[model samples]
Target: MIRDLLHNKKRLSLPKGTGILFAMMFLMAPVQIVAQDTPRVTSKIDSTHIRIGEQVQFEISVEADTTTLVVFPEGQTFAPLEMVRASDIDTFRNKDRMNLIRTYALTQFDSGHYTLPRQKIIVNNKELYTDSLQVLVNDIAVDTTTQKMYDIKPLAEVSRNYSDWVRYLIWGIVFLAVAGALIYWFFLRKKPLTQEEKEALLPPFDRALLGLKQLEESRYLIQSQYKEYYSELTNIVRAYLEEEVHISAMESTTEELVAKLEMMQQAGKLNLEKDTITNFKSVLQKADLVKFARSRPDTHGAEEDRKVIENVVVRTKEAIPEPTEEELLQREEYIAEMARKKRKKKRITTIIIAAAVLVVALGGAVTYYGFTKVKDTVFGHPTRELLHGEWVNSEYGYPAIVLETPQVLKRTAIELPESLKQVISTNQTFTYGGLLGDFHISASVTTFREGVEFNMEDAIQGSVKTMEQQGAKNIIVKQDEFTTPSGKKGIKVHGSMDITLPGTEKSEKGEYIILNFNEKGAFQQVIIIHRQDDRYAKDIENRIVNSIDFKNQ
Candidate 1:
């Protein structure tokens, strides 16, 4: 009787709802038939068990017709086990069907037994589900009771490494090379002149005579420009004395020039006649009177004076003794040396100006973006992403230290002293972190009673003491005048300290600041503490300090 009832299922579905259910099942039969007909997917793992946090490989393979499109799972679709890495799909063809294989690196942090749920894979507008898998993540077993423990190794003494010395040596050699090249080019390098050089370096008497001829051609004496005439006359003679006779005649008065000539004559350097010296003195004195005293000379007198000046030049040349071989050689060497020095001086001036421009450009970049950024642009820094991340603008404390920061500052309760309570009628504090944290920020505002005198130095010292109580050791404090954005004068105190976190044995380097502002009876204070070497925190400290503004201002 039971077998007959089971075989009569078609007769049992005569109801209207049951007939609709059969029609719907018939319509979905093709999808089920397609999935059952082909072995499209298979999921497998290398091992069913693994040590916690150890990686395991999970593979999924598919075999399909050549014209099918397949898409694998991506992202955090696997919840119990994290996907460490996912491999690309590998495809191969065998006869009519295409085979594809994909691998995933998976790990689990916790020690537990987990099930990887069936994953959906799409192939040619059809959904195919993979088989469920089981993985057991077990903790590493250790027998501490039977194992012996060893003390930590002490710090080893280390000498300077060869690479460090080599780097320094390379830099030193480069510096010396640049300095030596500059010195040689500027001071010691010798450049000999060609035959044309001798022609260019005319003797003082020849130069002066040529100048006088040019002056005559100018015809200033005929034009009644006595001042111009006298000025040229004096310059020609003075230049001749400076170049040939080794006298600073251009920088001397008329009397001093004459005295120098007499001294040279007495020293046997020259054989100047008494009349020649007298004629030279008279021409110079008359020229000075015309140029400086505005005295005019008649044309005939000027013409006679010009002739006398020419004679004086001729006489002085005759008075100069013949140069010895040694003297001639020395003179040639001196001239060559002077020419070289002039060329080198010009080159050095250009180099200095270029170097200054480069330095100014580099300094401006560093000042705006900081040394870390500048270095990153050259060598690279690790914290560029964090330093330049999005920042938030917010207000904190009662009097309100309004500023922008990378993260919002949290409020903290601070205990007040009895004496402080009497002077500070109302105060509030908002903070974010502690001394040893990567970034710390705090702001405090206090309103004082009438006729209250707030000592800034005392308050700063007290703050340092408070930091010491809070586990800051080896504290070093420094103070400087601070001005707010609104131009109110204030005090800024900054320092470094060694901080030991509450649950850690190691000490960390820290930097901190205390900025105090007093306007009338209202006092605003801000404090910052952070890791010393964290560039992002230091940037935040500077940004906060510079952004402070007072309502009264």
Candidate 2:
């Protein structure tokens, strides 16, 4: 009956309670499925309270399926609290599920109560949030009653390490070696000699004999190179005659050479036998025929011609006359002059090379180290010396002002006019250097009579007027409020000015800073002046300004 009614789309009546229960079961089923798929995110801190500047570790954890991508928060997401560091995300896996945890180190400098905002975590493109945390930062307690206070110590000098300069020294050595090699190769090294040069240096007769020996040992005869052999043989005898007899034998034809020899014999210049002359002429004509006319001579014939040529050279050398004493002396002087010229040339070359090397080394130094650094190192700068020198920390004047300076300040007597003595009780001054020097510092304290109120504006105007009276011109004035490290407030008057040197018309751009403070019925002033565009001077001024302190009476 129930199946027939349900199949026929008939409304089957049931108890009201049963109908409501069925409806509730269907709605809860979908909710359970979604709850199972959602990722879980939680956060906690190591401590709820910490001292100021103490670190707290805050961690966030997420559990999700392996296929889900989880991203944790980054950067300074915690306001009023600083993130000291962030650790890498750690992953733990269990079958198809994974857990990711990330830790952040957080701290706060000020003592206060703070709340860490909820951090956002993303899982599979869905946003998830962790719970907010509350933290309290407590200040550290100090027992100032029993603690003793000491004067601020002077700045300790830091010794520079010279190890860094070793690199420059090594580079200098490399450059010097390169320069030396170039000089030696171009100016000092000696080269080897060629075969022709070696022969030319020998005596003419000896050179001719050597050439004939070389020709005999050559392969020309074995290869049936008759033309080359005969040509070389004739050249040997021609070279000997040209050098020994001072004749143009190499350029002359065989007929011309023979005619010239006969003329010299007739003129009594050469005592030559007819047989020697005939043998030289016959060999030359045969060599010319072999060279120009393609005439071939047998190896035996060529060997005989070489023997004749050697004999002729010997006879010609014997016929030449010996040089006289005057000629020998003149030859010696010529050789001496040539040697002197060669030495002078070498000296000039050496000087030029040395200059170039010096220039290169200097340029390298200027390139590596700045020009200003090299210049200051070579020619000392006063301000640079003061900046690197030992410094002094001292107190000066009543209600004493404490500061550090490169040099000790000297006390100078201050004279108050009798007319103004009734209004001013005492004036004390301390100074270092002068207005026109590279750097100057002056501090003064002036006590007033009873019921005299000190005016800082008037004092600033007076100081500026006094500077102008002392040859400061084109002054530009600027004013600003300044507070010392000890919380002493004062007015800082500073500007640029043109200062004329004493007894000179030249002016230099200068910078000055005046700090004025009035305390305990006394007016105190600290003035600093330095040349403009001086980096070391600027550093000194900054150091002195920063070190100024007022001691409580």
Candidate 3:
């Protein structure tokens, strides 16, 4: 009976609600099929374990329809792991469907076990998540017991970089070229003479004659240029009268000039012939008419006027009296004074130009390299030279203080007074420069007599007091423990102060460092003093302090 009931499903009776559920299920079947066709996202890593600071590749793959838009994970979304780099999305297509794969380089600097959080991806407005991944970062292994130790390497000499100096050198060459050109133009160079200059060099009488001859050869009269012809003719005669007769003929009117010449003849200053003066006046009037009233003269009339002007010049030249001996000497003196003034003017001009070039060159250098560098380059800085110069490394004094310095320190005798002779045995000093100088370095070693204990604190105090005695005022003191490169420990006393040099009341800001060490009942001190703002001096102080070491007895 059960088998008949199972086989005869069409005959079996169903409830009313069950039929509605079946209809609902039949309608949702297509929706489920479409949901299954949605985009799929998956993620994987190349390795689950990596050394610290090492990179691991993480890949994300998405499968979607060609029409679907997909967005892969981006940025630092992976917690506990840093993304080093993200690669471009790679796509593979098969008919209507496509696969997109994006790779990310990830790294972790720390050693730990971490889980890469699930990454979010979007496809066609639907959100999807990739499965979380496990990662392990292991520390690099080291066995220090088997490793060998080595001494710290000494400072290697750094070759100076001349690339920056190349520009300065080019500027220097340009400046030299400009200076040479100016000097040659103002002083050494022989310039070709202009026409006017060549004319001025001739004597006044000869110059006027040359002008008349040149005008006679000119085309002014032939070209109906009557104004030019007459103008030149009159100028020649007027210039001759002015130079020979000592009258202002060129600037005076024709009437004023004739009147002056007649008065001079009456006074016996000039022995001019009345007929010569009359002819000179007539030629000047005709030239003025041609110039102002547009009066034209025939070529033959202009030629006759030129002849009269030439005759008048000759008569005026003959009438002029010879100068006395005193007058001749005065004229020579005047010419010499004028020549001196001309030379003085040239020298002044040359000096001004040279100074201008120097200022410009210095300004350019300061603008590019800075004022400090330019000043040091031109004038020289002692500290700067010592900073870059070859250094000396040697041991000094007993109980051997070994260090390096810019220059080898010279040994100096320190005489102890009779009062302290009983307490101190031997004191040796090596020094360069002094307290008042720009930079100073000194090393002193003093061995106390038997049964004496060296006290570092007392030594520091005594050193400060000594600086005060040497014109240092307003001193600030700071103390610290210092360790040398060779593992010797010492007391470092450093501070700033104002130093007044002897013979001058002005005080300059200064900085100082004093390093004191005690070994085998002997006290050793290294003292450095320099201008407060000297960077090179500070570097030198640092290098020397770092290089200090005690030699074994």
Best prediction by TM-score: 3
For each candidate in turn, the TM-score is 0.36, 0.53, 0.54
Q: Pick by lDDT: which candidate is best? A: 2
Off-target runs (Cα >4 Å) in candidate 3 are: 1-185, 188-192, 266-274, 343-391, 412-429, 433-439, 444-477, 481-491, 497-510, 516-524, 531-536, 546-553
lDDT of each: 0.79, 0.86, 0.85
Q: Is 1 or 2 the stronger prediction by lDDT?
A: 2
lDDT of 3 by residue, 28-124 (tens): 7764334345688888899999999999999999998898999888887885788889999999998888999999999988787988889899898
Cα lDDT of model 2 by residue, 1-553, tens digit = 3344334442556644555565566657764334465689988899989999999999999988888988888887886688999999999998878888999999988787888888888888889998999999999987879987789886465664444356657877897788888888878888677998888889999999999999989999899888888888888888888888878999999999999899988887788888999988889888989999999998889989989988988888888767889989998999999999999999899889889879776788799998998788557788987887778899998867888998888888867679668878788889999898888999998888888777789889988998898889999999999998778888999999999999999999999999999865678899999999897998899899899986543
* TM match of model 1 to true structure: 0.36
For residue 471, model 2's alpha carbon misses the true position, in angstroms, by 1.4
Q: Candidate 3: lDDT over CA atoms? A: 0.85
What TM-score does candidate 3 get on C-alpha atoms?
0.54
The full ranking of all candidates by lDDT, starting with the best, is: 2, 3, 1
Candidate 2 clash figure, as a count:
0
Q: For candidate 1, give the lDDT of residue 90.
A: 90
